[model samples]
Target chain A: MSDTSFDSQTREASFGDYFALLKPRVMSLVVFTALVGLLVAPGSVHPVEGFAAILFIALGGGASGALNMWWDADIDRIMKRTQSRPIPSGKVGAEEALALGLALSGISVIMLALASNIVAGALLAFTIFFYVVIYSMWLKRSTPQNIVIGGAAGAFPPMIGWAVATGGVSIESIMMFALVFFWTPPHFWALALFMKSDYSEAKVPMLTVTHGRKVTRQQIFGYTLLLAGLAIGTGFTSLGGPVYWAAAVVLNLLFIKGAWTILRRDEEVAEADNYAAEKSFFKLSLLYLFLHFGAILADAVLMRMGVTFGGLL
Target chain B: MTFRPDHELHKRRKGRNIGVGLVLVGFVALVFLLTVVKVERGGSLQGFDHTQRIDMVPQGSNK
Candidate 1:
């Protein structure tokens, strides 16, 4: 698609269209993980400071999303899943998206520095740069390992949140980062399996598109095993309690089983069922992160209430 | 052709410009207020104390 395709519009853009440019779904995950990171850290933050920290972190995440949309407008136009996005749909121009993204990025980073500490603001700035420059601009088109490496950009939020509270990084924050980093591969590969044609059509080198279904399934299974180990191992850290351990065990079991199911299916059966297993795994992956983070938040609250547990064996 | 001041598209664009300006102004004001609150609460804006230090001497001693 040509850039001119987005130049013609029959109506004015609505507020919702501008909001969509921020990729609210991704921003929500960033906010939740960052909140968990902040809440679970060792120190306490004042209520207003905590609120401001989260707000700035969210803005930073939204800024990255807008920048991603701006750069990926061409591939996004080709992909069925992203064709209705503001830039591609003639609701917002690419230059407008770029300006909004840059403006938000500057405001979010500077304000976060003022509201929290320099470490956190710097991390947020690096996260935005990593996502926009490294992942979106360079990696996504260049490599099938894009999501694997690109996952770090998304994984930084909780660490940023942890920094917001403690003004530094800790093992707990690193574990939180690792949790998301490991979870990202299997989570996105499942979506790739279901949307293989979209990636191929966009000429974006998703693992499924480049390596074929068998290799992709194997990779998913391999990453899931590693992710399961990390998820369960995280339960023994200071960040975890009985609640988190139990949630980890159950969620990992389900996630492993989902990966196993996908691995067992051949392309013929997968096609016949319209990739139901992959879709189901994708949905479960969403819940897997939410539940794990929820468990951590619960553990933090319990600890504050004087409830404690010995590390799970 | 005669000059026109109130074309619908022009009016809508003006409204949007004002709305965006107001939002930016509101954000600046909020940040200013937060900074004031932080200073009032004894939080250092520069991450360290900026007050001048003074030396003390014994009551009967002269330096």
Candidate 2:
């Protein structure tokens, strides 16, 4: 009849706690882009293979998330944004996270190879390693260019999906990679502009914290312009069609406008308005990537139905 | 008594245990389905899991 003992038990690791270590939100993005990449590729995939490819790709992403939590536990304790993560909140042990991440990494790689081509499996393995080792361990706390480099880790899933179907890399896969890569800096810099305190407190040298907000805003604008050009240009490739072209034109115009608005504001105006422009830019970025991939998927479907979309070319 | 009372640790970790069980089951099923699909598509027995299964290969196989 001791409440103290039960109080301790209340904080013990549960299934949900372990799941939280996987960073399900980030895994969802990996799944979405990878699924789009698979569906939009030139060759056809067996449905089961496609399902297994996405599943293991997601597992690989989740494994990296767990390993990232394991590595960043110290800073997660300090950052308000990451304070409630499993390790920081004491629901999961760092060692358990390391174990789960490693185990899942091996299983996912092997299973993906068995279920699909070795190309996809190898890319998934490399993605996990790049995210956990290169980005999380090496670059994260060391440089202002961390997000720029780490974004490559997030951008690999779609490429891996493309590999699953075609069994090799291609121009379209590289384009998808470039799309996510260029989009990452602006998207993260916007969050950094508003959540400035988190990076400073954690001593993570984010672009905003190191280069100052004015420069960060400029970089966001610069990257957004590049992203707009790349996104609009992707529509003219074999990946693009009338459907994709329309989506790209509208999305990029809105995106460039958002980035321009962010670039125009100083911290004075941004803080006065509670970072409304920066926050909206962050929200739009989520849609920007999703709709770009969605448009590509729609184009692929139309092509499958024997409809020529070169009229708007 | 064949059915004894549950241990306190077991009672506390029921959800975790069940979740792990389900995951294990799902993994087995996925592997099974993958094997079936690979076989149905006329894939060789040697490279099923990306492993070189020499024993499964014929004796005179110059692969």
Candidate 3:
């Protein structure tokens, strides 16, 4: 085993390590939501341009993830969950990650401009900047609200997808953005509840670390309620459909149940087998967002078939 | 340093793994290169213009 000490010259990077830095999982989520946004919007986009937009958005997301990995290498090294990450494991050098991130940032933004309009390109660029600069550099170390604000960066993909379709932002796109924005706090807080030691060890000011566990639980429930409201309400917008509405209702109920159960558990009960309640909620949160977007895609398909739902039905 | 019984065998297998990995990487690169060429020669994004307007509704109906 390599020495645990942080050193500049100890570990050489492999291709897999570099790939891991891109956070391919997160990038996939960005690509899917952005694709849904583009497909469901009212306006038309050229097929080539739409493909390019999604490609660029995915690359931009990857770039942000790379930069985040670069910046958080220190804290990542200390945290068990992140210790195997490229930078922390010394498989990829920080400078290389930074360079890869910067290069991809420029390429993705430029390609987006060529493929689509300037608006989509600009949004893509800003999303990268927000994740790398605002979220990683500024908020992450300074406050527990890091993920809350950084969540906006993740939220931009849908809006960019909308811009690719319409060449402008719409209320519908913003609603999708808001859905993600509100959902982020509770999702991440649940994660923090389970991974409290990870943050505490890294000296990161997660909500659970800065505040007491009870406060974090209450906040999680509060955000869950807000997320449920926004999610259902968002389905009433231009993008909403019977499929989306049904999905939202089911997902939100599950999400609320998860949050409520987490709230009711004391630390003793939660930590009985290593924060089982909190961990389960965190895992479910990932599925919740994905199912919601999947429902949106389904709704779009159903709407295309000329199916509408009436109150009685 | 402590050595497991299979350490030498594992070390020997590393070369084969590296070779296979490189070949896979090369294949993927070649595919990407062909795609870029095709994209450049052919039109954009596989020419998927689903955005073409189909006008069933009267243009000035809203007006």
Candidate 4:
């Protein structure tokens, strides 16, 4: 581990540095998916309770980010893409980041339990532990399948939200979890295809680094196929409707096509074009999750309206 | 103790720390208040109906 001590010459850390430690972009995705889960669950949550649930969920996600940054500071310093992160950049000390992460983890878990229920609180706590301890500390440098298994940590927020509303899990929450879980491999592999050197330099066992580009590309296509099935299958569930179904069909077709286009490209072709196809696929993956969750929320709202109006008719 | 020359920097850091501490305390108080409200209202804050029985009395107490 790198020295956790603070540098005396280091300037005072700004609020932005602390915020960067939380990884706001990832936190936004957590907030959005958790909101959709709460909205679509069978039971109703008061608006205030719902807000509190999402807030605590987002805090939990942020805590995980801080802890991940703290643990990964050494490798992060070596990677060009992550070299500017707060701890690596010397804007914040590693010890400070660890302290912030632990504090937020406690506060978020306890507040979530009070605001929602024990199940959601427990799930949030588990999610943090999994991401920080299992994924970041254990799997990240040890195995090529790190992202494949570690993806579960990212996939738990929506389920946590569902649990908050209903005090339990169900098919709807599981499908939501599965969607993110399966989408992670292809989504990350595409980026790995482009940023191969970063993983090699950091000695992280990403599939692209350990197994070669050909194997990684094939895996991306394979996972995308499974993701397509899960995405469409989710549309048939009680949580889905016509809007969600149509959205799922269109989005999955586009995603699969993107994966296929990536699979067809040789490394030479990818390098020549600066991994254009892979980059585009990576961009599409971001849209894929958001649209899927958005459709679920829309479907839930539509179904509620249908039941409310059907009573009058 | 080491001699410190940057007195202004030290003062600024102290001010910032105090500010952050106050904000944290305020946030904790807010969350506590919200939790209390939710529990007292029986898992909700809307539609106050306070006529529910507490069952605090004995079954046949004349005193």
Q: What is the lDDT of residue A212 in candidate 2?
A: 88
Per-prediction DockQ comes to: 0.17, 0.34, 0.07, 0.17
lDDT score, candidate 1, position A129: 100
Better of 2 and 4 by lDDT: 2
Query: Which regions of candidate 3 deviate over 4 angstroms?
Result: A1-12, A310-313, B1-63
The DockQ value obtained for model 3 is 0.07
Ranking by DockQ: 2, 4, 1, 3
Residue pairs in clash, model 1: none
Candidate 3 lDDT tens digits, A104-178:
899889877767779999999999999989999999888988888989999999999989888889888998888
Predicted structure with the largest lDDT when compared to the true one: 2
Shift in Å, residue A40, candidate 1: 1.0
- Total clashes, candidate 2? 0
Q: After superposition, how far is residue A125 of candidate 3 from its true place, in Å?
A: 0.8
Question: Worst lDDT window (10 residues) for model 2 chain A?
Answer: A1-10
Residue range A1-313, candidate 1, lDDT tens digits: 4434433433466556677888999989999999999999988887677888898899999989999999999998998889999999888889889998999999899988888899999999999999999999999999999999999999999999999999999888999999999999999989978875677888899887788889999999999999999888788789878889889999999999999999999899999999999999999999999999999999899889887675323
Instruction: Give candidate 4's fnat, 2 decimals.
Output: 0.03
User: Per-model C-alpha lDDT, please?
Assistant: 0.88, 0.89, 0.82, 0.88
Give the residue spans of candidate 4 off by over 4 A.
Answer: A1-10, A307-313, B1-22, B43-63
- For model 2, the stretches where C-alpha displacement exceeds 4 angstroms are A1-11, A310-313, B1-12, B43-63
Clashing pairs in 3: A13-A91, A47-B48
- lDDT (C-alpha) at residue B42 in model 3: 49
lDDT (Cα, 0-100) at A153 in candidate 1:
96
lDDT of 2 by residue, A1-313 (tens): 4656665577678898999999999999999999999988888888988898899999999999999999999999998888999999988999999999999999899988888889999999999999999999999999999999899999999999999999999888999999999999999989888875777788889888788889999999999989888887787678988888889999999999999999899889999999999999999999999989998999899888888856435
- Over A12-55, each residue of candidate 4 has an lDDT whose tens digit, in order, gives 77666787899999999899999999999997887778888898
